[model samples]
Target chain A: MSSEPRIFDPDEHDDVHLETELPEAELSDEAWETAALPDDLLLLGDQLRCDATRLHESHRADRLQHELLRPERAQRAETLVPARGISAWLPLLWLLPVVLITAALVSNGQPTVPRIPASPAVAVTPSVTPQAEYSPQVYSVSLPAETPSQHGPSAAELDALLDLMQNETASVAVSL
Target chain B: MKICGLDVEKLTSLYFDRIHRAALLMSGNAWDADDLAQEVFLIVANDPTKFEGRSSHYTYLYGILLNLERRLRRKRRMHQEKTEKLAQRQDGPTAAVAADVPVVSEEWKRSLWSVAAELPDGQRQAIVLRFGEELPYQEIADILGCPLGTVKSRIFHGLGTLRKLVAESPGQLREIPRELGDAQSDVI
Candidate 1:
């Protein structure tokens, strides 16, 4: 046995030394190639390789194949079922825009603010001071004063009144 | 040539058992291992294009499995913490109990595996990848997303831990070879 200091040289080819140090049957090719590692570590590596091989061999490969690798068509069908369910209502989706527009028009036509009561008690009155330059014209519209229980006008009537008021205002401005 | 343009069947055939074994070792149980393996394969199946062939396909698969394992571990840790808190609240000042007991069985491999499972996640992963999967240090480094030296250090420390654990139970050492036993002292 050469007890002399062996220099760390990759070039020094020693097949016999390698064979004696790492038996072919026990250690793997990778373990054999890692010559720099200690013999004990190499032995551990061999043990590891053997253990891994045993574990690998013990697994049920068929079970994995059956679970993971089903036919493409079956897989596609499984996946597409949800999408097909969604697509069944494709005709209904076209009505979305129409429904949305109708909602918008209905909302726009409705008066946002509720009409104030005609009762003078709740009506906000403007205080006027008597002065020669402060003389203002007052216009009064007669109302058929009714109890709060009676409905005043339908929404359509209110809309018609609003349109008539707007037209009158435009005509007065044109005349002016 | 390919399963849905991904060569998944080929990759699966090549590395399925290895991955499953790695998962088994990582999870410390067959049920979790099955779930982990199924999750890994599902990810690969869903988007096979993510594997760009930069590293070996096995390394790529292991990387995905490791990420999934980390997530699973995080969830397990959270659940454990909540359980511990609840336990403390309900049963005040309870003594800590050891999770792993010495194996009464004669099989040293099962004992060894259980001890390996007791190791910290990084060390356990290193040991499993090195010994259980037979991956080289560089490949382990790639799979772990760490430096080569880090991988070596992890394996060394992991093996040292395993050696200590096995030594704790003298009865388990009956099957260990003399040289391997001697090598235990040499492990730094």
Candidate 2:
């Protein structure tokens, strides 16, 4: 296929005009000289550009090196992890003691409670024992009837005892 | 400061003409031309990615320069317009043709460059590729990412306009008046 574009004259329909104008001055020596430019201005920019590119690439390499070699937060993150297999089991270890205690308590509850043992005492000899006939020299001395006697604590007395105990105890004990 | 793939010192020795010509073609002012070329180097040095291997290194660099010129033009238009207004105000009443005109030698070149600058972007690009770089039409089209006909039109129109501008300037064969010299005159 041809790549050239078709040229259409639009002047027929659009009433457009096409004019080819020519330069008035024949090329003068001075004009030619003026048109020719200093070769340095052209290349200076590109040369500097090349130097700049080298510098940039050097800096970029340095930056990449820095990025790759620099210490990262990930290193500290690794440090945050416990060392060895022991570290892996640390949580389960803490839970083991609690589990043992709970299991022991639970197992203990499954068994019946042991009965309390009765007191054991050996028989003693009755020699030199006083008989009821000796009257046991029994004498009753009564506390003064009119005077108030200290006896088993009264309901009011017992209440006062408990009130004092309650006062002395910490709030924590009461809450419990 | 640096352009990758191009050796700065070596390019300074070898390719400065090419870079300067490209700049001149893009920017009509010589001073601006040099500055633009320098700026292109800086761009290439700073970010070589802009030159992505779509064309020859020089062509890619040329593209960068042209784009930069456009951006600079947009940025400075308002400021330049204002400055021109101010300058006109300052110099208008006193402006006079010198009795002894000096250096008519470069008048043609300066006028030609000015006319080239006034060419539309597409046409100017076509001329730059065709004449400045001497690129073939297909390569020009490829570089411009345009149809072949468009490139042809650009070259034709660009040359036509430059010819008209030169023909119309003072001390010319044609009756090229100020009105005809105005930038808005349609493509013919």
Candidate 3:
């Protein structure tokens, strides 16, 4: 009932105001001692202390990579089991507008560059430039056709096909 | 590669576990804690200028970490809000999603740390730094960028809240009240 500043009396100390007069150094000590937590809180503290380490052991770089890459792993997991119903294609959903716009643009006008009439003085010839640099490198390799599987062409047919392929490649190179 | 005059790998190695531990205590999930820890370092690695030698590297990283924890908790709360029945939505697919997280006990999920995690960020950080990390109150004050008295008060109230929560629940504490979760968000 008194509004006056009360004097510190050790004898009248209750748990609530137990540390009001204590120094900062003794506040935690005095408070924790008197306001002692139950065994459960102590147990929790012990578990935390044991678990909360300040420094980790020397981890192998790869091991660190493995741990550090957990977010990537989560992303990969999300990717692995992509959204089943409609969500799976959510990423590609944006492409819908893109495709629609592309189609619209294509249909609106050809997607080709606008052809400019050549100046007569420039003499733009129709002769090939022999684009060896841009020609596709055709590697000659044996195909499954050489082995006559039930579903495969015979070796003779394969040789004919190879010859035809060579002819086509040469023609394509010459065209380039 | 070095940032803020410390090697990135060396920085990662030095405080990685400690940050993870602090984060784990703050977030009651290993997966989230691991992510938060990685993010703290990522931010440091990305922007070294944030560390202007004003505070120790640990404290600077901790400040970044706490900011991230706030953001993460906000995101989770949003997700939790969306999942309204987050309590009933335990185990199963969540476990599958957290496949790489170290196996933590379900019992721990319902422990004091879980409830402590629900404490206002200030109190939770104070409690974790004080009791979990066993740092001196002065150091906690430094890490939290608050007065020593504020740090002490936070830890004290944090523990008191923990006690009240335990007493109210009377068993493995689960169902955290929204009021309790929002009771304190600052270093009051």
Candidate 4:
């Protein structure tokens, strides 16, 4: 069988009078043949039609069975009732997290603990002298005379100590 | 005379089978068909004024069903694409490569219905409405919201594809005599 579709020209039927005017019985044999599709194609169409009809019938039977088994009005009404106990609150449980998040967001905008002003730099300077003995003496001895005044030994005092150490070293060398 | 401002009993008696059958063909499955059929009726029942009497009630119902079917198909396609993309991402580019597998002629031999199912939405719908529902071209055009010429073209191309698929399994053609008899009885 050729796979090509036999095209029906609409123009061929244009000259024919209205369909109601000319019933099948009134048509000539040649005219009827021309109007109808090929026998082979019709057979194919019939086969498809049969399959579709069977499918539809089966579906209808299934639908009828389903409808027959469907829950009655009373059962449906029962389902609509609110569930008991904790299950009843299940719907409202979703709001907990949302409320908590909103509360946290609102609270975060304000400081919880009072922020104390940092201690003044002058107060911190007085505590530094007690720890000065642990400081490297080289840095203190190298301080220039023009260094800024602070709570540390003066450059003149550092020079006098250096002179006394030199004199003691020279006397020990002469005695040896 | 009416249950919901429309003749519920009359509508059920006259159009229920055809509408449900159309739904089945459009959906290609029983579950979706049942849902689509009920939805179509529900829409009609909810607002009888929407009918407008412009065309046959069947056409109006079919129009609604077809529109719903299109949306379902689009959603399904999008889901499939998403799944494919995820698979490619997990398995690398090699997973995305199109398989070179050939169409199995034996599958078409087993069931022509499967081949019909594989057709594009337009072609499948046209074929179903034309052959399954036995609707006239003009009515199909109305339900599909397309021109008469478009309906004819869809059916033509759809049938041609079916014929080509069937031709793939020549051995199956030999079995047509028995099948044809069964088909004739079922169709009539």
Which candidate's TM-score is highest? 4
Per-residue lDDT for B141 in model 1? Answer: 78
* Per-model DockQ against the true two-chain complex: 0.06, 0.01, 0.05, 0.10
- How much DockQ does model 4 earn? 0.10
Tens-digit lDDT track of model 2 for A1-176: 99999688566333122221213124342232133212221222223234333433443465588788667755776799755555666778889989999888977888456668897997988679555565466788987669677778777877877797878774433221
Candidate 4 has which clashing residue pairs, if any? Answer: none
Best candidate, DockQ: 4
> Which scores better on DockQ, 2 or 4?
4
* TM-score: model 3, chain A: 0.19
Model 1 chain A worst lDDT window (10 residues): A16-25
Give lDDT tens digits, candidate 1, residues A1-176.
98999787765445323423323224443543353345444544455556556555554554567667668657888888755555667899999999999888877899656889796667668999766676688999999987777457777777877788877865422211
Give candidate 3's TM-score: 0.48
Runs with alpha carbons beyond 4 Å of true place in candidate 3: A1-22, A25-176, B82-107, B173-188
Q: Provide the TM-score for each candidate, comma-separated.
A: 0.48, 0.40, 0.48, 0.49
Clashes of each: 0, 10, 0, 0
- The runs of at least 3 residues in candidate 2 whose Cα sits more than 4 Å from the true structure, single-residue gaps closed, are A1-176, B1-14, B25-29, B84-111, B172-188
* Poorest lDDT segment (10 consecutive residues) of candidate 2 chain B: B96-105
Model 4: share of true interface contacts reproduced: 0.25
- Greater lDDT among 3 and 4 belongs to 3
CAPRI category for model 4: incorrect
- lDDT (Cα, tens digit) per residue for candidate 1, span B79-150: 667766766878854333222222222232554566676678888888788777767767887888876556
Per-residue lDDT for A20-95 in model 4, tens only?
Answer: 2334334543343235434454566778877776765666676788788676755777789855567766989899
